[model samples]
Target chain A: MSGDTRHGVGVSPGTAVGPVVQVAPPVRPPDDEPAPADAEAATAQIQAALATVAGDLDAQAAANAHAAPILKATAMIARDKGLAKAAAKHVGAGLGPAHAIEAAVAEYAAQFEALGGYFAERVTDLKDVGDRAIAEVLGVPAPGVPSLSGPSVVVAHDLAPAQTAALDRAHVVAIVTEAGGRTSHTAILAAQMGIPAVVQLHGATSLEPGTTVAVDGEAGEVTLDPDMALLEAQRERRERRAAALAGVSGPGATRDGHAVALLANIGGVDDAVAAGAQDVEGVGLFRTEFLYLSATALPSVEEQADVYRKVLEPFGSRRVVVRTLDAGADKPLAFANLGEEENPALGRRGLRLCQAKPELIDSQLAALALAARDTGADVRVMAPMVATAEEAAWFASRVAAAGLPKSGVMIEVPAAALRSRHVLAEVDFGSLGTNDLAQYTMAADRMEGELSDLLDPWQPAVLDVVAAACAGGSETGRPVGVCGESAGDPFLALVLAGLGVSSLSMAPKKVAAVRFALSLHSLEECRALADTARAARSAADAREAVRAAASPELTAVL
Target chain B: MPQRTVTIASSVGLHARPAALFVEAAQGTGLDVEIGRAGEEAVDATSILGVMALGAKHGEEVILTADGDGADAALESLVALLSRDLDAEEG
Candidate 1:
């Protein structure tokens, strides 16, 4: 279609060729004073813009009924009095009705972000309303290339919320954003939708609409204008891999039929509910920090109870292991503000901070206990960064006193793993937070992209920690689960299963792949994978060894 | 005006739960009490946000003050409450 096009990191692995679909950003012409030159005329213009945006949203909702939930949520933002008043303020600030809507929406979004949580979530919805209003005001399509007839990779400079949310999963084979990160909304949503995506490309949007592209999400590389052979190969691989993984279901059981729990690691109560509502076995890890992080002050006991209740309700009687507030200096709280630390990751965090502030721990435990009592959900509470047996006992006792049935500790610290037997001796269960465990064992900063080499869960030392913790778990007659990014990798999941982990908790999208991996190998075969990984000299070697031992189908997914 | 000084007994000092508890206790009293570090201008004790904003540390001395009816008794009770660890009681 045009000269060779190039772009940024290819995160998801796939290939697609499609007609170029150009998505223009929502246009907002500077508001010109209406001919009437009165407040009432400006008001009517704003009203008309809002009505058009609402109608557009209704049309979209009808087209994608499944999007009703998010759309309804956005409508509330569109109708928010705060947003309306703020827009009116912008008019007084000397902006036209169109520009005023943008200004007001942006202001409200910023304020909501400052408030955080239920309010912060409104930011996305507000932005959506603003985008639609601006688009309607300018009589432009709502900033997205829609209705692609064939499977294609979507390319963009930096996708806005409306653009990303509007993506049709059926037509979008992959996503390549020129500017974004792993934590960016586009990447996260793409991952959620199970669409391969790469971000942080230099010239993603410059590619002609409807061009052939190949993306390797795992390798984080993109090849623009790929030759026909490479495109075909990627397409074939994607199909075969998707088919193979789809064939797997049920629990993550060993080849010999030892049932290993396949769980989901969720970020918040909503995620926990959504993941737990699935046919999957249970939730291996539910991160509770989101509630605290989303609030400017500590969430009240009642507020925490409501969130915990929702998270536990979906799983019903299934096990839902909740990790208590794991925040610290790195992700400090507004109220529990720990002053700036030189090395936040290694500084006060997880159980260490809990120990210092037992009251905070007590309130959390009390809330969990109250929620458990109300829900009657099979729940277990755990603390993160537990190092000593005393810490484990301290946390366990507190949890028990709060009326919770069981208490567990996350074996992420090297010391805890090395002495897991003693640590597990004090708790009802142990779950390996391998991401942090690997980071700590290798003494690598997780935020350092360059140190990604050392942070691999396959690292020999990291595997040793898993094995040791599993061993400790075995000694205590308590089960342990691996809940980290590694658990999603089929090969690494197999290795963990081989090492005696009773559960693998990861993203919901990765469940099928792990289940397939576990089914392909017998306990002996998986044990061999773990042993080989243990014998490997480096993280890369360990990964290679695991890859060599696993089925090609599973290895490809990895 | 009545005033008394007491150490921040809670391990995390006067932040989060302890601060919330202090604010609650102050609310229970019908007085316009102000809490502040000794020698520092006191702030409204009824304001949990304000008391937490003080960020008083463990072993730090904070003065409680109030005016009018029952102010003396309210200050005395608050001083006693702040001198012992509430977390220990709960534990």
Candidate 2:
């Protein structure tokens, strides 16, 4: 086992020891294999491999329907005409059947990435097809472990898109990818799946498969061949966590019975529909940019409307708060192009772009209104990066004109939060985007991992912004909510409620834990807890205060 | 071919609700009709999905196209239908 050192990506979380179970990489030709006597035989092999990949994707999708819609869509592309036919053309070009398949698939995948948006989504599908075809030609199981049958720390050098998607999230305790970034899709998905994953671990592929390992997600560490005692301790911790998180439901309220709406922040209409199907109260932040993210130009008013309708239809009478496009130079669009700047986040983005391009804002507003009218849902629209009351008022007026009932502004800028009263006065509600708020308040770059300490939501400066925003919300009589990562945290949720936030929005999976935490304390207790946290000197001290003040059960879960 | 002018009633017109309505109307006519901004070239109108995909906005002007028996009548009726508010127009 030690000699093999099979390398691939470590996806998911947890550590277990088991036998080697390599999900071999897709079939490919031997370096010295002679030309086949019959082209027909090679063609047949390629076709069979493609069909097999398609079948695997379907099976995986059916098994994990709740995972991500992109999985199913990628499956569709694997069997698409553009891809299948493109591979056949390579055969005509006289490349080996396996080489033909790999070359053609790569071309499309590159094209999709270049195209971005919906097309860029196809990159994973193309990679899947390529891997499978090459594996079939080479006579090996596709790369990565096919199934983690026992508790073991799986090792991998690099992970492909499908390999990452096909991860058995339940069995895998933690993931250590040799080559990947924290912002890579694998990392994002792992975080969303509640699995501790550490990427960019050098020599991950050098570890023997089935070796006992320990992973610390918060620390981004993977310890290979851990002692038996450590494994037992980790397992005990996990089981305790499960018990603590059990029975979380209904609205997230504090011990004193102060009610704070618990909602899910979703990216697309599909996500809205799926999460809405769950027990979530309503959609907290419906990222409206998805409707236009993949488009060559700004989505037409009608295009935006159709999506809004689909998104709102799921929530019905439930409130669906739509956030207008948050794109900027960092997330540039071909149609709504903004030139590069020294700092994309601080540069023209969010509400600033909407100001420069009222037509884009108008189009989004019109669609949202149409969806509201069609679905009869309580729809609300909000603008991102509103630093001034003027921007908020400008956005609100447009939303009202578009025929939507309510409009609000996201207080991501400290200036906006400090003057939140005035900004909220112009809008119907306020939602604090804590991630951006923290970044801006502390003068920290979000992308800079080294500033992770400053970026902590518990940072005094970040909390100060939240407190100011909440106070502003109260002054204006407009309800406020936290829709950033901090809201997903149970202890923080209580503090936010104490700060006068009316709602807490987070990933759907986190709602239960937060709700459970809130139920353990009263509104007054939560207020006291918030004060204790605020009085602390640093983020660490503040975090400790929150933990100490929280109920034993909540503290244990943390 | 027949032509008519209509404001995209749905605030974000032609792309969302207006587009859906236009697609439905073009489908009903059984005429090879096209729709587009007032002065721009029109796309195939019969395909509801395609028409909606165009993303026309509220209060925007769109030209309609069709040919053959009752083509003129179909274009006129469809254009008139498109001019109205879609939510009220829908059954």
Interface RMSD of each: 10.9, 8.4
Q: Please give, for residues A54-75, the per-residue lDDT of candidate 2 as tens digits.
A: 6776776677655435455445
Give lDDT per model, in order. Answer: 0.74, 0.71
lDDT of 1 by residue, A395-420 (tens): 98898788888999998898999898
Superposed Cα deviation of residue A316, candidate 2 (Å): 2.6
Model 2 spans > 4 angstroms off: A1-172, A177-187, A198-207, A214-240, B1-91
Residue-level lDDT for A116 in candidate 1:
36
lDDT of 1: 0.74
Q: Candidate 1: list runs displaced more than 4 Å.
A: A1-173, A176-190, A198-210, A216-223, A226-239, A553-558, B1-91
Candidate 2 chain A worst ten-residue window by lDDT = A1-10
DockQ of each: 0.02, 0.05
TM-score of 2: 0.64
Per-prediction TM-score = 0.63, 0.64
